[model samples]
Target: MTRRGVIAAVLGSAVAGHIVLGVVAGGAALTAIRAYAAPPAEPVFPAPARPVSPIVSPRWSTERARNDAGEARTVIAALAPLNGRTVADIGAGEGYYEPPLAHAVGRKGHVIAEDIDAATVTRLARRVRPLANVAARLGRPDDAALAPASVDVVLMVHMYHEIGEPYALLWRLRRSLRVGGRIAIVDADRPSGEHGTPPQLLACELGAIGYARTSSRPLGDGVYLAIFEPRALPDTIRVCR
Candidate 1:
């Protein structure tokens, strides 16, 4: 009868069975969940009211050039040690970060490389299949689709500005973080439309969706690395305009 009731009815039916269809939201028919491992009982937040920047390109730079610049190592150093921990590489376009991260995390550690593009995920899966510890999977624009409390660190490199539904995405992503887990985001100091997210705007958007910035620093070449920990989600999340 009410909005919450409708969402509950839709999600509740899915949890009870293998599939559900025709979820109505925002006066439009949304594709129902084909499968759900364990859907959260928490309410889903509305989409952000702000303008989302476009995804300019898949590969920001070549792996050889980035390695020569020591980009991945520098970024990895900003977060807590990854040895024997689980790390999810969000927006893993070409799987550039997989090798270095796999080495850092050690053999006991695990890496989940995710991309929204199905083809990219398939290619990435094949590329990393040789590595015993890394697995590649397709993700969604509004949801990282990570397992709940399964990851120690979530890494987003040069891809934060491309997320269309920041509010909804972050809200869902927060559930994937383990206790004391942190999110690491690397981007440039510029407008999102220009293929970079300004640090202030980034903070505003993340803060609006219940994340606290732990530390941020410039990582040379006009790029920056910011780390955040999840905080309690507010009753209603505000959009950064």
Candidate 2:
């Protein structure tokens, strides 16, 4: 073949390869630009809003109710010595303990059964209406509806850990107690296995809220009881069960 012919063939091949390379590069750049312009994917679903009131349905669950009842009885026994005295049962579900507590306090002493749920409040009111000494209270998210420094005892049975705002509730409870008023916290001793707060964490949180750990004793095979009181009060005011 002639030298010119060979040179022309080589030059033609080089131009063709250059064109192919340019096309590939342009295609890749276009793909990248398109990917960059695409919008981000939306979330699968929106998160539900935080509730304003305590969840009542969870309290009425069969297992929870039974646990609450047993803990309520223990709390009653602990406060039994305070006969004919004012008591407030915070988070009183289904009024299971309100009736007996009202009876213990007698017609003269007052019992405030406070629940955050309006439905639970209604149930409590119906259960305690016959008793003149008992008053059903519907609580707000930030505070209990009880009168400040009016209650001689505050009972929170198997319900403290479930509170959405523990610090706010504890502060309100502290304010509600009389000079020598006592606070009782009863909860499951063992781990719930669910993602609920553990008993030790409850005690620690209560202690942080100015409550002194008075006693921690066994309630049943797997359950335990803890009693706490304001650190400023005398030791005799807070009784351990």
Candidate 3:
């Protein structure tokens, strides 16, 4: 007879003591459980509201940044103690950061070049094939798919804004960090599509995911590098399906 009455009738009898909700449209049924018994989980920061950047070849960005008045050296310095350690290059376009990572970690160490696109990973695999220490792997939009406690450093250069699911991704990153490991994010203060993430917002999102920003400095030539360490106890991460 009424909206509430019809909903109750459809969800009737089965949920005796609990609240129920159902939506019927075009002969399709969608049922939802409304257990108001306990408080709902808190919401995490939403993804940035900005245009997504077009994925480009690493040849344009990778080496150029390296040549910029020691930008590459400064980034490596922030991720210090990387010798003989494992590193991940999230969104490793064209294997741009792989060579440096491989060199820094040395022959005893390994580098995981992870990208969300299969083609990108394939190309990166080919690009880094010359380096014995570097390998490429495909990653998901919401997860980098890194092994637990397997990486000493994770680099997200000019790519944090391109991530579709930052909260889930950042949370997943926590599972990849070893003790004393660090995350280095490089970007400018411009809008997302313009190739940058505001340092304050970047810190806030990472902080929400249980990362503590240890230091930040100008990455030379406008880009900024912020370094963060994982907290001892991570907060309950919100999984984005």
> Which runs in model 1 stand beyond 4 Å of their true positions?
1-44
- Ranked candidates, highest TM-score first: 1, 3, 2
- Clash pairs for candidate 2: none
Whole-model Cα lDDT of every candidate shown, in order: 0.81, 0.66, 0.75
Query: For residues 105-212, could you state the per-residue lDDT of candidate 1 as single tens digits?
Result: 999999999999998888898889888999998989988899888988999999988888877777778778777788899999988877788898899888886788
What is the C-alpha lDDT profile of model 3 across 174-223, one tens digit per residue?
A: 76777667888988887777777878878877766667798888865577
The TM-score, computed over Cα atoms with residue i paired to residue i, of candidate 1 is: 0.80
Cα RMSD of all models vs. native, in order, equals: 13.3, 23.9, 14.4
Model 2: per-residue Cα lDDT over 120-186, one tens digit each: 7887788788889888888875578677668888887666545666655665677677766788866
Superposed on all Cα atoms, model 2 deviates from the true structure by an RMSD in Å of 23.9
Runs in model 3 deviating more than 4 A are 1-51, 56-65, 232-241
Q: How much is the lDDT of residue 68 in candidate 3?
A: 65
